[model samples]
Target: MATYAIGDLQGCLSPLVQLLEQIQYHPEHDTLWFAGDLINRGTESLETLRFIKSLGDRVKIVLGNHDLHLLAVSHGFGKLKRGDTLAEILTARDRDELMDWLRKQPLYHYDESLNTVMTHAGIPPCWDLHKTQTLANEVENILQSDRVDDFFATMYGNTPDKWSDELTGLDRLRTITNYLTRMRFCDENSRLDLESKEGVNTAIKGYAPWFNYPTKVPHDCHIVFGHWAALEGKTQQARIHALDTGCVWGGSLTALRLEDKQRFSTPCTLNRKKT
Candidate 1:
């Protein structure tokens, strides 16, 4: 069976279908690792969610910021935004089922055999794989509970920007969610800058790409993430792959063949309007 890691789908289903066809993906025999942001911004959020969710065990997804935001909005913890394209999902007949499934998805997934760790955004420099899995379990518990609305209600924000063992309550929950899904840059001290999404060279003083910080991440493992489409699918660091190629913004949808790391891309249908 083949395994593929794909960039953010962002509700752009047409390109995703074409990409799968290009790779000759067979749901019965292949696995797809989605780097996340599976919905939002594009025109067919409902169709995209239903398609992926139908794949069931054949697909693996890590919760992206947009994915979580959809959950938050579904629970009435967050409001719909002006440009949001998630109305199709929110208003879908299977909204309840889909949202519940999304809530149960994990924030990080690690594969020991593949020597790879996958998240929607890169892990914090301060977190080793073990700590990341532990913290991910913490949030996962809350999300899996019957009363997870309490967690989602407080999940939005940029406060408590620093990670600490002492942080508790909603502040702690939000802080963890931010780091796992929204993080981009960090200061030299390793505190999440939260606001900066620029590249390493253009990052403001003291802020560096999360993976570029001084501490050691396991050099033997590979890191795969999306978000920060402005990275335009770049990491400039070996074994670290940035897969958000801005398919929603007229770029191509990308997929990385897991066994050999061979890449295949399909030009986005969003860009085909002019053709």
Candidate 2:
């Protein structure tokens, strides 16, 4: 009955398989949590998606920015970038089923007993778990509705720069998605600074790492996330874990055993395709 959290697979199925073998994962008894980017950059997008789909109730995933991009691209709301492995998925025979399943995944997950919370990226510094879950439901409702197309249409943006109860409609959805997927840095006022993607030394002016902000972090609970591979798998906080070890860039695919937080990693064989 172990639960294991894995970092961004990015369509690198070989390393994923190796890591699964290393952990001796049992579908009948174990659960797997994915930090998203389940497909892209690597060569086996179709295979990766199918593997996950076959997992039934044994797996859980939070959507990443790349995952959202794949959904938008599939529906013609966005265009695929060159070097993206998503084409394999878009052309798959079971494309509709795969895409629909992906869209239904929650943006965040929480476990009460373990006090572990998972999202593709870090939660905003200004948001407590209650507010974060509430906002997550707002988008989830749209994603699960007939208006889903309209939701994806308004999905891209960094506007409303900070969270406010006043934010409504598409602006509010965009802000929530950014916090759950693209967020990294924030200013003193807790406004999300979407432009900075560099390491700690090169932070965009006045912005600091979301976890390093002056206020008390969601430190009372264990937080597991990916998407910031440039952290190169480093987080200064014990309760926070950075699992994206840059596997798509020739680093290792990482997995954390939930019961005792034991780690398992396997070297990647990446082709370095940009997405």
Candidate 3:
């Protein structure tokens, strides 16, 4: 049985189906790992959510920033931006069940057997694997608890742009969430530069992609992430894989088979629509 790690779906179910067919996936024997952003922007958000949810144990998913935005919008916390195609999902009959499943999804997924870790975005250089898991759980518990509304109320900021052990409450949770979901570039000191969305070369002065930042603690496991579609599935590092190929932005949908690191892709057939 093979395991495939797919990039952001962003509500593009057709491409995902095509990619799975190309890989000749057998759900009974094979497993799928999604880099998240499962819904939003693309045309079929509702269908994508239902299909992925139906996969059950055959698939694993982490949460992306867009996914969180959907959660917040569902609860009247966030406004729908101009190009958002999430209305179908919000109006679905199973909207409650889908959103509940999404909120409970972890922000980080680590597979000991594969020796790989997956997140929607890069992990901060300051966090080792153990610390990463611990911090992820902290937010996960809050998201799945009675205080979830409180967390969502304060989850939309970029303050405290750096990680610190002394940070508490919403500040701490927000920082962790950003690093795992929205982070792309950071300074040598691990201060996240959230504004720079361009490719690696366009990083602001004194900043570099989060994966390139220096770390006091080292993590040996491979990292698989999907947020920066600008990279187009290229990190130039063997262990660091960028799976998001911008399928929602008229690029190709990609997947990487874990056992042999084989890459598979299907061209996006959706109309070129910006989000």
Candidate 4:
């Protein structure tokens, strides 16, 4: 049974369907690791969520920034932005069921056998594998607890801009969430550059891609992440896969077969929507 690490779906269900066909995905045997943004910004958020949810144990997904935003909006804690296509999901018959399943997803996933890890964004450079998983669990614990409502209410912010073991309460959880889900650039010190969303070339001075920083993770370990569509599946590192190909912006949907490290892509046909 092979495993395919896929990029963000972003509600582009048609391309995802075609991509699955291209990859010869076998639901009963093979596994799929999705780098989040499973819905929103395209045209079929409801269908995409339902389709992924239907796969049961065959699929795994980490929560992306968009996924958390959807969770917050569903709970009436956040507002929909201009390019959102999540209204259908909000009004769907299975809305409660889907949201329940969604909120239960973790922020990171790892396959010890393959030494392959998956998160919506790359792991923070300062964190070792153990610390990464531990800190991720800190947020996951609160997010899945009775305090979830309060978590969402306080989830939106760029403050405290860095990780500190000394940070307590919601601030720590929020920082962890941002690093795992929203991060793109950061310093060697792990101070996040939350505002720069452009490509590496445009990253403000002294800030480079998070993957550029030295980390405690062994060099051989593979990290599969999405979120930064501008990379177009390029990080120039064989072990690091940046798989968000901007399918919602008329780019292609891409997937990496973990077994052989072969990459497969299907061109997207959706019209770009202004955000």
203-269: candidate 2 lDDT, tens digit per residue: 8778888888643445578889999888977889888888999998889999999889899999997
- Candidate 2 vs. true structure, TM-score: 0.96
Give the residue spans of candidate 4 off by over 4 A. 272-275
Inter-residue clash pairs, candidate 4: none
Cα-based TM-score, every candidate: 0.95, 0.96, 0.97, 0.98
Alpha carbon lDDT of each predicted model:
0.87, 0.87, 0.90, 0.90
Q: What TM-score should be assigned to candidate 3? A: 0.97
- Ten residues in a row with the worst lDDT in model 3? 212-221
After superposing candidate 3 on the true structure, give the runs of residues whose Cα lies further than 4 Å from its correct spot: 215-220, 272-275
List, residue by residue over 44-156, the lDDT tens digit for candidate 1. 78889999999999999999999999998988889987667888888889999999899889999988888989999888888889888888888889999876899988888
> Which tens-of-lDDT digit does each residue in 87-124 have in candidate 3?
88888888999989998899999998998889999788
Cα-based lDDT at residue 228, candidate 2 = 89
Clashing pairs in 2: none
Q: Write the per-residue lDDT of candidate 4 for residues 1-275, one digit (tens) a residue.
A: 99999999999889989988987888999999999999889887888999999999999899999999999999889899998888899999999999999988988899988889999998988898888999889888887788899999999999778888899998988999999999999987989999999898988888899998887788889999999999978998778999999998889999999988999999986764566
lDDT of 4: 0.90
Instruction: Name the runs in model 1 displaced over 4 angstroms.
Output: 271-275
